[model samples]
Every structure is written in C-alpha cells, then in structure tokens.
Target: MGGLHADHAKPDDRPTGLPTSSATLTPLVVKMLRHGRIAAEHDLLDIGTGAGGLTAIAATRLGSDRVTSVDIDGYLVDAARDRLAGMGLSPHFVTQDATDALPGDYDRIVATVSARPVPVSWLQALRRGGRLVTTIADTALILTAWKTPDGGATGVIERDWAGFMTTRHGSAYPPGLDELFETAREADGENVKLFRYPVTDIRNNWEVWSMLTISIPGIEVDFEETPEGRTAWLAHPDGSWARAEATKFEPPTVHQSGPRRLWSELESIRNWREVEGGLPLYGCRAVVTPDGAIHLSRGRWSATIG
Candidate 1:
C-alpha cells in the first residue's frame, strides 16, 4: 500500500537482474482486508510480503504477535523485516516458497500477489471456517472464500477489478516466449480476413482484457498507435497469432494463423458483450476444492482455473 507508486515502475526502467516485488494499492489492500473479515483475536498470514506494507497494517490492527508474513524472495523478506523493525514492530517473518508448507494455522490468510491456483498449502494452513482472500493470475478476478467442514471452500468473486503481479519461485520469471513471438512475426498465417469492427485496443479496456484472458489463457497481446493508425498483435505459445491494423472508426485488416483463430475468438467475446451488455466474470460464485482447483460459475456460464 505504501509503496504503490514504486511498484508501478516503468517496464524499461526495471533492472533485468532483479526480480520485482509487487506492492498493492492502499485502496485495494483495504478492500482485501475487509473481505477477509479479520478480527483482533484472529491469527493472520500475510502472503507475498512485498515491502511489508500489508503486514505492517495487520500488525498495527491485530498486534504483531498474531501476524505471520512469508515470501519467496529472501531479499524482500530481509528488507521488510528491517522496515517493520524501524517502526518498533516485529512480526514473524519466514522466507520460503508459499506453495510449500507454511508455518502456523491462521484464521485469515491474505495474498497480495496473484496465484494460478489458490495454493493447496494455503487451504491446509487455514483453520476450518477461516477465510482466504486472493486474486487469480492473468485476470482481475478477486476471490474470498471460507474453508468448509469438508476441506473445500465456497465464496464469490468480488465485484471490483484488482490486479497484482504473479507469484514466482525463483530469482526471476522464466524467459518470455521469444521463439514463438519471432516465428509469429513473419510466418504466413493460414487465414486472412477483413475485420468489420473498428480497431480497439484491448489492453486499455479492463473488461475486454480480463474476458480475453479467461477465454484464451496464456495469450500475449501488444498494441501501438502509429501514423498509419492503430496496430495490434496477439500471440500464443501454441503458435497461434494474429495481426490487425485500422484507423479510427474504420474496419481493420486481420490475419491469423495456427490451430486457433485468435482474433475471431476475441471478436466473439466482444460480440457477446454487445448482446449481453456485460461479461459474467465479476460477482460470480467461486468454489475451491482441496486439490486446489477453482471453479467460477454465473448463471449458465462457468470456468475453471488451476
């Protein structure tokens, strides 16, 4: 929360040698804390302790002894320890992979970073009836569920759209899909068609971007406004790719290749929004099994992420 500005460092300015930690915005942190339903008597775990901001707030509200913080980055853990110590507050700090065994049972567990599958260890560490608040990776879907008697958890996705950096297990994330991107740049796509809709920058539209992520996981997107108009590219690790270009209020030219029609899929989602007036991602019911599979359902539509 405190280091929100620093966490948003420009991509070009970030050092290539160090893994970056994510800091949550103050407002979002408050929302997560409220959804967690933390109480003064409850024990808490602050996962992904980037800069110790959330840990500090919890310690101040719940006392230092009742809070435990863990992170994979030893460097970040050490820095957070020192920062908390400066305020005359010291909470238990453990430097380890969060997906591994955690230290203590807690009534509340809040993660500031996004996880692919609400980690299984988190469910094991939470007491029955305890709450876990977190977001899914690659999308702005916030989940807050309470552990049930049978080891599964049930809850709903928050209406707000909040995003954080994904968790990592090493010094840095694995290299990007350079080989796939390079091939997609020049490879002749199998299908070329005229796109009837005006070129839209999906990245700038949170709803469309989030829906696209759910519809096509692991897809990468890029956009640029050039003198010719707007150009956009979509690439997937499976060799699927699409390139589109168009000016304001004009239809774009689209070319796609690989096993999937990436642009057409996007257009389908856009058309669905046009018909339904919105997406079914937010405020949906979320159920998590003990094995760490998460399922979200709203009306007749449902999706699973693990």
Candidate 2:
C-alpha cells in the first residue's frame, strides 16, 4: 500500500480506518512485480490488499486461482473483493493481520505495506526458492530475498527507495507520540552544542534518513524554512529532542534536551557519510534467520534487527 496519509483535497480531511493514503500506484506495482520475478505458474500471496489493485494485476498476470490477497481490515477486504468482482475477477481475499499466520504456501509473497524485522510466518509460508518482496517499516529500504534451504532467506537491499505505510493490527493505527511530542516541545534538554555544518533536511536525504531509521528507531523529525533560517526539530520517544537553526553557509545553532543526544547521533551519521562517501544501507546484504532476526551486512559494518 501507499503511505498512510490520504490524498484528499482538504488537508485536514483524511479517511479513517483505511490501510493507506491511496492504492499502490501502477508504476510501483510494476516495480514490485519486476523485483519479485513472479512467474505465470507461481502461486502468489499479496499481503496488504489495500484496494485490490496489486491483486488485480497479479490475477491478470497469473490466474485468479493462483492469487491470494489478504488484509487486516474486513472493510478493505470486502471493498477490494467488490472492486475486483466488478472487473470480472475474483482473487482470494482474506481478512487477517499480515503479521499473523497466513493461509497457504506460495511461490511468491509481495507485501505493499512495510514490516519491521519481517514476520517469521512469511518465511514459513514461502516455498523454498520462492522470492519475497517488501520494505522495512519507517524506512525506504526495499528488500527482495529468495528463501534458502536452511530456513533462512538471503537478499540484497535494492538501490531504489520506496516507502509504504507500516503494517497495522486493526482498522486504524494506534495514536502517535502525542504526549512525547508535547514534552519534547518544551523540555530543557540535558545538553546543547553548536552544529558545525549547514542545516540539512534529513527527509530529503534518503540515504541518511534510511540509515538513521535503522540505527535509531522511533525518531520523529520535522523541518521548515523560517525567517531566522532553516529550522529543524528532532524528537524521540525517550524524551530526547533537538532544535537546530542555520542559514546559507553558516554553521547551525543547536539546542538539545533529554537523555539521548539525538542531534549528535544524526551528525555522527552525517560525518560518517562525509568520510565514506555513502551509507551502507543500500546494496547491503540482508540475512533473515529462522528466528525473525534481520541481519544487514556491508563491508565491515553489520547490524541486526529483531
């Protein structure tokens, strides 16, 4: 599925209880198909059947009998079923949590939504030598792996970046970090330092953003251009917060509070990239063990996600 924000004309009017802002775009569906390397004979599992667009396409490619689509929301499932039915197609549509046990073993599993440390059930359901295409939650890292004989999967991070809404357990997602955000807004941080670099918006920098998400999960960031300069705020669930301001070629003035120095961590990653030329997030080797741990290795550095 696409991102969680709706594509309504009114910015304040977003659909509730929906899996994503919109159905997976056609180009992205094509990309997933290309990366999945699906075959006409392969039985495919389409996780997160948001609007049935991907399911329809798969059904059209492979027979409808060979396609199974699932989602957590009954409403979405029914809607997707109806949409497909209208087009004279009836792919299997199941209403179940993507993280939960799936129905049948398949040769290909493609998830439009993102998952953290991909669910173990996916590996179990995937037929040996089958491929699974998905993105990691909160990051633009797209992973496509082939199931191995040792009950593990090995793959490389694709150089292309794409993000989808994180998987949800219910009709709607839980509330965001409102209380934590409010606290981070005014708390007197533990330390402050001058950032000897130009203010940079991390969101626009996909490589750094992806690396940071993997290294430090649950960090929320916001940036805007102000009369004072380029201003940015970084907040963490653990009460860490930082405010930075800079203009043109001048260094940034930073104010930080809370236990962790969030800005320092960001700067450290940036410094590493400055020295290394690029982050290891892309083109890295990913190994998913039977226990649901995702290990990423590139050069001499490695990290594990459980």
Candidate 2 deviant stretches above 4 angstroms: 1-21, 226-228
Reference-based lDDT, each prediction: 0.84, 0.84
lDDT of 2 by residue, 106-154 (tens): 9999999999889988999999999999999878889999999988799
Q: What TM-score does prediction 2 earn?
A: 0.90
lDDT of 1: 0.84
Model 1, span 1-306: residue lDDT tens: 122234445756535432356667887788888888998899999998988899999999999999999998787888899999999889999999888989989999999888978888999999999999998887777889999987879999899877787777775677766676666666666898888677787876777888898878898887778777987788888878888878865888888988999999999888888899999988999999998899989999999887
Q: Which candidate is the best by lDDT?
A: 1
